[model samples]
Target: MENERNEDPTDWDQIGFIISSKYRTAVLEQLVDGPSIPSSIASRTSLPITHVSRALRSLRERSLVELLVSKEKRKGRIYGVTEEGKRLWERIEAEGMVD
Candidate 1:
């Protein structure tokens, strides 16, 4: 998660990327089941709202996850894993990396 944008986008390991942050991993895992509001994800993952927001922003940046609500909405904005996120998550889960 440290200056990873500089790496070749194709060369970057998506699985490794999510695995590097518990926040990111937890958010992804929660979304894997289905899209949910940030509050639900934070509550289920036992992570702070701040952390979840950061993770969401990062994942969205890579097109791994997406906002399911209007961008103008300040609250109740749901988030869901993208197909790309599902693929990376499946690879991570297959390796028993999910908590």
Candidate 2:
């Protein structure tokens, strides 16, 4: 489904579908607060490390989030919303789409 194209690329309704998984949404929420690594996200959200890793992978596949840096001794990554992600997030918030 990643290859599906929308007439409007900025459509949150469509982007949301990709990121609508409960865990994925939670991951986005964690990133919303600030840039964080997977371990921090798991700790803060009370999610398993493996689940967070899987969610992050899915999010990256959809271009909703990005890996910032992984250097030195830090094996984790910092994730943040992309421009496309921000636009979709704004639209979702404006539409009161959150449960």
Q: Name the best candidate (by lDDT).
A: 1
Residues 1-99, candidate 1: write the lDDT tens digits: 676666556534787788899999999999999999999998998999999999999999989999999999998999999998998888777768876
TM-score for each candidate, following the candidate numbering: 0.85, 0.75
Q: Each candidate's lDDT (Cα)?
A: 0.89, 0.76
For residue 48, give model 1's deviation from the true position in Å. 0.6
Quote the lDDT for 88 in model 1. 80
Clashes counted in candidate 1 amount to 0
Candidate 1 regions with alpha-carbon error over 4 angstroms: 1-12
Clashes of each: 0, 0
